[model samples]
Target: MSEPFYITTAISYPNGKPHIGHAYESIATDAIARFQRMAGRDVFFQTGTDEHGLKMAQTARDRGITPVALAEEMSGHFQTMANELNISCDRFIRTSEPAHHAASQALWKAMEANGDLYLDRYEGWYSVRDEAFYDEKELVEGENGEKLSPQGTPVTWTAEESWFFKLSEYQDRLLALYNEQPDFIRPESRRNEVMRFVEGGLADLSISRTSFDWGVKVPDSDGHVMYVWVDALTNYLTGLGYPEDTEAFRKYWPADFHIIGKDIVRFHAVYWPAFLMSAGISLPKHVFGHGFLLNRGEKMSKSLGNVADPLELAERFGVDQLRYFLLSEVTFGNDGSYSAEAIVARCNADLANSFGNLAQRTLSFIAKNLEGRLPSRAAVQPVDTELLETVRNATAIELPRLMNDLAISQAIESWIKAVFACNQYIDAQAPWTLRKTDPERMEAVLGTLFIAIRDLAIAIQPVVPTAAGKLLDILGMGADQRDLAALTAKGWYEELGNSGFTLAAPTPIFPRLEVPAED
Candidate 1:
């Protein structure tokens, strides 16, 4: 049996509606989880909304609604979007849930027991927008010549009685832990940045907010609420039934990956791990911080009026199209730009023209010439053997890199390259011309092409799931395999190496997108 694998996307803050950024993270994480499942792993994937925060509180007040009401409505929308995108999350944890509250409080109690929790009077610059306290050196000058938070939001001086986590005490220990296990933070660059930050200096972090009552209440403290990050990060454990439930926690704790955006790299890589260490819990294996989607040169943001409404994009084109565009256009862990024109171009070139057109033509030829049945493989040609060998070899090379390094976009590209090679093989062999001259050779060629297409569909499913599934259905391989694991050089292919496939009438997998001519 394959080993157990656990992954999670950052729990989104329910301060606003879902945008392309949220969709991007979800789709990327979903692909990884789906791929792991295909690899025969017991995968636990979790995602949900961060409903306890000052932003959610203010949004509630602005709309004359209770926080619970607003969070419920927005959380439902997030769920709807995830379902629409076919997100295979095992748990959708909400921090406001009783289970999550208990788990978070339990973590606080654990830290207290560990002597990491202490009472402190906080007097510093706080950014309400970020719900974070910033040091003077970390602040930058605004256009108005005032100090601003790292997020560019203005910071104000605040004084409050709060509980603090003695983050400074663990700087050397955290560094030692990271050095001991270098793979604890992923992608090298993120790891280096985190190490630099830790080495520069560490400060105690305020863990409670006395100014707001919009979060997990500090246990035994009536007037203060737990910090939003502290509350939000606990969802990972809460989803696993932590604290009260020992068996479940043991089963899924110490997640394999935490997929977060670049903006929160520091939070996930440094603060989160430190918190875990303080509580004597094992840290996660990897904190993979992927970059954001850019609209032109600027970050996509709601206030900037540049955020893409996920549902709108899905409605205008299609969910699979959007999914394909996001995953294929951008290299994972790198920032990428998105434009409608680029989306249309990729759809037309890669999808409609390349893979889709090849499928249509191959099936059409078989249907018209061979009575809609898979041609019998009576004899093998050099080209047929070469094609199958290329597939087996490429699968061997790419699958490990994709699985171990999480190189998702490269994995899809590798399979697409194989598909293009199959197309070229067919065009050069001229199976249609050979059909009359040498029917047996033609059958061999078609047989080889059919199996190649089958493998292609299976290999590409994790990236473009819906389209690949449709193509596999048309090819009559849908029932035989659900993933690339089915395409191995096993007894089935070798035993029937001379057999032919009964082809089906193919439909366009991805129809070409056309733009209107300007008036």
Candidate 2:
């Protein structure tokens, strides 16, 4: 059996439509999942909407609709966005699902049984937008002298009868977990920030809210819903059929990763592990807090009138083009900015002009000159050997190493270097010129380019699935053979030649993207 690899994205809050940030996380997580699967892992990728919250309730009320009705309507938009972006999530869980409610209640009961629950009167500043409670010291003063959450979201003073979890009791344990694992939170920066916050000490967290009832009801606790974070965090388990010892629960429990935005690091790194420890459940292997996506060096916001809808961007640039640009332009684990011009230039240069052009010209040369027949083997030369080696190193070795370390941009960079090498080899060898002088040697050169293009296409499929798949199909490669192992296998080219698979007049896989006109 392949090793099980489980990953998840922070479920989007469905009070609004999906944005560029949502698309970025989904694309990044999906790429990792696809890479792992192609690398021979049994991967389960989960992404969805966080539908139960005060914000959901308030937004529904403002719109004169019930919260459930609003959740259904908005959650559809997120699902549509994921589909449009080709997110390969195994499950799209909604908190309103019966199984999820059961899972949340079960987790709450387990925590309560461990003596972590207590009744208390809670009075503090709460940020509705963030769905987080903030300590007085963490608040910042607004220009109008009003207290704001650390994220600059509005906060209100609230007094309520709430059930509290003894989060302070796990402070020492959480620190010890951090010290022992050292990688529970990724990107040294996020780990350092979390360690500092824990060292500052923890307060008992309010686990149930009595003011609103748009969430999972606390087990045996009347008139109260579980804290949105608690219900939200439980979703990771619920997707795997938790609270029941089923096959998925047994195999994929203790998630491999929880890929979330940087702003929510505390909730995952601090509160989540503590809750699992209280429930006697295993903690996830890692929580990676990726940085935000900005709009051309500025933070995107509604008031700024610059929040880009991901679907709109996808429509403007092709889906694969958008995916390739984001994965290449942004250094993972750091803030990235995108613009129309940036997307167009990046995709056109990397996809259309470089790899796409190399594949198109090489294949077209073979189809037009060789009557769409596979090139026969000719005397192997040192130049051919060297070119193949360069491509193998990039596609088979360097790219995998960087991808495994979550260095997505660097991995693509390595692949592009190989693409550049192929372009350079074609130019220097001048296969078109050789066709007349030495047809046999020309056959050898085209054969070498064919092998290199196949390897490049297989390696990059995880990032640009549609375009790469189309190119591979044109190359007569089978779906079963598009993997890392296949990239290094011997004699596949000979087998393709024997099979007499003819290349067709190819359509361009990656068309150059145009910048949309200003309205």
Candidate 3:
């Protein structure tokens, strides 16, 4: 059996329509999941909406609808965005699902049984937008002398009857976990920030609230619902049938990664681990808090009128193109800026001019001149051997190493370098010039490119699945042969040649994309 690798994106809060940020996270997570699957892991990837929260309640009230109704409607948009973006998640969990409620309550009961839960009157600063409580010390004064959360969001003083969790008691244990597993929180920067925050000292957390009823209700406690984050975080376990002894839970628990935005690192790194310790559940392996996406180097906001709808961006620029640009341009743990110009320039240079042009010219030449027949083993040359080795090193070795470390952009950089090498090889070989003067040598050159293109297409399949699949289809590669293992396998080329699977005239997979006109 393959080793199990489980990963999840922070379930999106569906209080509003999906934006570019949401799409970026989903795309990045999906790419990583695909890479793991291709590398022979049993990967279970989950993403969806966190539908229960005060924001949802307030939005529903303003719109004159029940919270459930609003959740259902808004959650559909996120699901649609995931589908349209070709996110290959195993489950799209919703917090409002009955199974999720049971799981949340089970967790609550477990923590309570551990003496971690207590009833209390809570008074503190809360950011309804963030759905989180903040220490008075953590709050900063705004320009107008108003109080703001650390994220610069406005905070309101909130006092209510609530249930509290003994977060303060687990501070030492949480710090010990961080010390034992240095990579429990990723990117070093986020890890350092989390450590500093925990080192400062932790207070008991407010885990249940009486101010709202649009959440999982506290078991045996009337009129109080579980705090939004409490239920929200539980969506991870709920999808795996937590509270039940299921095979999935047994196999895939202690998730390998919880891919989230940088802003929520504290919630996942601190509060979440403490909750799990209280409930006697093993913690996840890693929490990767990825950086935010900026719009043209500036923060996106409604007031700035730069909040791009992800679906529209997908429609304007093909899904794979958008995926490629984000993963290649963004340094994974660092913030990335995107604009129409940037997307078009990057995709066109890498996809259209480099890899796409290489595939189009080589395959088209063979299809037309060689009547779709693959070059036989007798046509092999020394140059062919050298180029193939270069391609193999990049696709099978270096790329995998970088991806395994979660250095996504670096992985892509390695793949593109291989593509550039192929381009240079093709240029130097001058196969078109040799077509007439040395026709047999021409066959060897085209055949070499055929093999190189196959490796390139397979290696990049995680990031640009559609385009890569299209090229692989035209190359007549088997589904079983499009994996990392397949790249290093010998005689596949000779096997293909002997099988008489003649290539047809190829269609261009990566067409040039034009920037959309600004409105």
Candidate 4:
């Protein structure tokens, strides 16, 4: 059996419609999952709505609906966004599912049995927006005289009888874990920040709330519900069929990756591991906290009224086009700015002018000049040998290494260089002109270009699945030829054209966008 690689995105909070930020996480994680599957791993990718929280209850109450009803409505938007993006997630685990409730309670009982859970009064300033508590020292006074959490979420003073986790006792242990696993939190900056926060000492975290009844009820407790983070994080386990599914739990447990936003890194890196430690369960291998996406260089906010809907963006630009830009433009683990102009410019330059143009020009020549039949090549020339070697290095080595590092931008850049090399080869060799004077040489050049396009299409499938799949279809590639793992089989390169493909008239897959003039 192949190695199992389990990955998950932080479940979306189903308090509102899906936005660009939510889509960004899904796309990035989906790319990882897709790549792993193609790389011959048994991959399980899970993402879904986090439906249990005070914010969900309040929002539902204001709208005169039950919290579950609100979750159903808003979660549909996220589900739609996932479908529109062609996300290849294995499961979308909702926190409200009975399986999730059972798994979460099992976790609570495990921690309680470990003697790390206790009943106590939680008295402090709580941020409803963040669903977190803040110490007096962690609070910043607002200019308008309101008390705010360090993250600037307004906090309300509250004292409630709650169940507490012995988070403080694990402070040194968490620091030790960070020391042992240097890549546990990712993007050195985020990891360093987590280390610093943990080094500052920790406080016991409130795990259950009596103030809200909209969440998973605490086992053997009176009118208390498990905190949102506990219920939300448990979805990862629920997606794996935990507790009763020990066989599967053993197979897919110790998740390989947990992809989450930077805003929630502390929760995953600190509290999550601590909970797992107390429960005698293995911690996830790594948690990557990616930076936020900004709209036009400014944060997306309600007051600005500029939160872009991801579906609208996908609708305006092609779905694959947007996926390409998001992965290629944003340096993984660093903040990236998005704008209409930037999106258009990137699509035109990278997709339309460079990649799409290359494929169109090559395939069109073969379609028109060669009569829809792939040509057989003569003995490889020195130039053709060099070009093929370069492409082989890119498709088999450099791109894979960059992807393994999660250096998404770097990987895309490396692939672009190899792809653009095909364009340069066609230009220098002048295959169109060769068709008249040197028909034999023209066949060799076109043959080499064909190989380049095939491999490039295969390499880019993880990032732009729809577009790359279209490219393969135009070249008459079969399902067997497109499996990424098949690239490494013996005779894979030599036999690339052994079965031979009949060509179709190639059309441009990515078109240049015409932006509306600003008023």
Candidate 5:
């Protein structure tokens, strides 16, 4: 049986529509899921709306609608965003679902049974917008002298009867977990942040909220409800049918990775592991805190009027183009800035000029000069052997290690290097000019180029699925020959054609994005 690779994006808050930041996480997670599936792994990728929070109830009240109704409508927008971006999550869970509520309650009970839960009076600073708590030291004075969360969101002091989890008791254990598994939290910066925060000592977290009625109810108590994070984070387990579907729970629990925004690093890296440890459940193998997406170097915000709609961006550019730019343009652990010009520049330069053009030029050469058939190879020349050897080594060794390390931008960059190498080979050999002088050599040149293109497309399929598939289609790769598993099993240079594969009449896989005229 293939190994299971479970990954998830932090469920989006449905208080509003999806933005480029939300789209960014979904696209990256989708890429990993696609890559894992292509590698023949059992992948359960999940993403969806995080319903049942103070924000949802507030948004509902302001709109004069029921919370459930509001969640239904707004969650649709996120689902639409996922669809627009071609996200491939296996389950799009909502915390409002009965199964999720059951799972959250069961997990709470397990923690309670472990002696981690106790009834207590909760008094602290809380940010409804962030759905998070702030210590006295963590709050900052805003421009108008109002107290705010460190994230600049307003906070209200709340005192209520709540259920507390003995997170302070797990402080040492949490530190040990981080020490034992250094990659448990990713991007050295975020890991350091988590370590510092945990080293400062831990507080017993208020796991249930008594003042809100819109969250998951405590398993036995009628007055208190599970804290929003507890309810929301449990959605990951709920997607796998925890505590009920024992088989699935046993199979996919302890997600391989939870891809999330940097702002929430503390929750996932610190609080989540503590909760899991208390429940005697396995911890997630890794949590990656990716940086924020800014618009032309400014943080995107509605009040600032700088927020870019992801749907508009996808429609204006192409979906795969946007996906490529998101993963390729930005270093996965670092922040990225996007603008119309930046998006257009990357789409055209990387997609059209580099990857797309190389595929077109070599494939067109084969189509026009070789009668739409892959030419039979001659004896491998020294140059052909060197290039083929390099390309083979790239597919077999370099790409998989990069993917395993989750170095997405570097992996795509490496694949593009091979694409450039093939282009360089064509330019040096001048396959076009060779057609007249050395027709036999021309066949071998195009054959070598075809093999390189096949491997490049297969390697990059996870990032640029649609374009890669089109390239493969035009290369006359059959359905069975499409997957990369076979390519890996049989070395890259081994499948040199004999009778020749027929080509599809090519359309430009990527047309350059035209810059919109200025007003």
Candidate 6:
């Protein structure tokens, strides 16, 4: 049997609409999921919205809507964003859904049974803005000398009666688990931070709030509601058919990866696993906390008026262009900036000029010169062997490595390098010139180019889906005929070993951008 792979992105907070940061996380996870599917894993990918929170209540009040109505509307926005971004989530699970609520309640029952949950008055510094409690020592003075919470979220001290989780009781066990499974948290840096925080000693966590009625209610509690993170985190299992149905749970539980942003690493790496263990549930295989996307050296924030509307950016630049920009701009686990200049430059350099240009030039030549049919080859030259090896080597080595590590940029760089080599071979062979002087030699050259272009489209389909699909269409390759798994599973030194190109009226996959002159 093939290995099973389950992946999820942290559900977005439904307090507001989607932004570039949300798109960045979803797209990154989607790309990895798609790659794993192509590599022949039985893959399950989940993404959704966190609809139950104090922030949801405030947003509802401001909009003059009930919290449930507001959550429904905000959840719709998240769905639209995922669709526009081409995020291929297998299941979009909302925390407010019946299945999710049931799963969460079941887990709560389990924890209760295990003597891990109890009712107590929580009187500490709580930040509704952050949906988190802050210790006095964690506060620091902002540039304006106002005290800022650990995440720089401004906070006010409040006392409330709430239920608490016995996080302090499991510190040593959590540390021991971390020691036994070092790969549980990712990027090494994030893991070190989580361990240090856990080792410093943990306090019992406030697990329910009485300040808002917009969240899940604690069983038999009059005013208190379950904490949003605790409720929200359970959706991973809910989406896998937990509690009521165990088939999907049996098949895909213990998620292979939980892909999330650096901002929420602690919650995912620490709180989540502890919650599962206390409830007698198995932990996820890995938690990879990636870096943030910054704008002008500041974290993108709505209050700062610096939110990058992904839809607006998609309107200005195409969706495929936006997808390419996000993956290519940064190493998978590092923070990076977003600039229009950078996006346009990468579009022109990598997509339009490099990969797209190779297809257009090759196909256009065949359409005009060889009556739009793939050239039949009867011989192999040293150059053909070299170029084919480049294509095969790229798919075999770099593609799997990137997908395994969730390093989208590195995988794309490896594929683009092959396309660059193919373009260079086209120039060196001078297929256009040979068409007139040595027609047979030109046929062989075009045949080789067709083979490279076919492999390029199949190899790159995971990263830029639409663009790669269009490339396949231009080559007259049937949409469903490409075998991506076979491509990646082969040996590096071996060629794709077949050509199935029939040229059609070709159009540019990604058109070049022309800068407007200063007025």
Of the candidates numbered 2 and 6, which has the greater TM-score value? Answer: 2
In order of appearance, the predictions have TM-scores of 0.95, 0.99, 0.99, 0.97, 0.96, 0.95
Off by over 4 Å in 1: 478-480, 493-502, 516-519
Compared with the true structure, what per-residue lDDT tens digits does model 3 show for residues 1-519? 999999999999988899999999999999999999999999999998998878889999999999989998999999899999999999999998999999999999999999999999999999999999999999999999999999999999999998999999999999999999999999999999999999999999998888788999999999999999999999889999999999999999999999999999999999999999999999999999999999999999999999999889889989999999999999999999999999999999999999999999999999999999997546787878998899999999999999988999999999999899999999999988988898998888898899999999999999999999999999999999998899989888888988989999998888999987773
Order of candidate numbers by TM-score, starting with the best: 2, 3, 4, 5, 1, 6
lDDT of 6: 0.84
Off by over 4 Å in 6: 488-501, 514-519
Greater lDDT among 1 and 3 belongs to 3
Angstrom error of the Cα, residue 51, model 5: value is: 0.3
- Local distance difference test scores for all models: 0.83, 0.94, 0.94, 0.88, 0.86, 0.84
Which 10 successive residues of model 1 have the least lDDT summed? 489-498
lDDT of 6 at 512: 80
Question: What TM-score does model 4 achieve against the real structure?
Answer: 0.97
CA deviation > 4 Å runs, candidate 2? none
Residue 170 displacement in candidate 3 (angstroms): 0.6
lDDT of 4 by residue, 84-169 (tens): 99999989878888989999999999999999989989898899999988889899989999889988989999999999999999
Candidates in order: C-alpha RMSD to true structure: 2.1, 0.8, 0.9, 1.4, 1.7, 2.7
lDDT of 3 at 412: 96
| TM-score of predicted structure 1 | 0.95
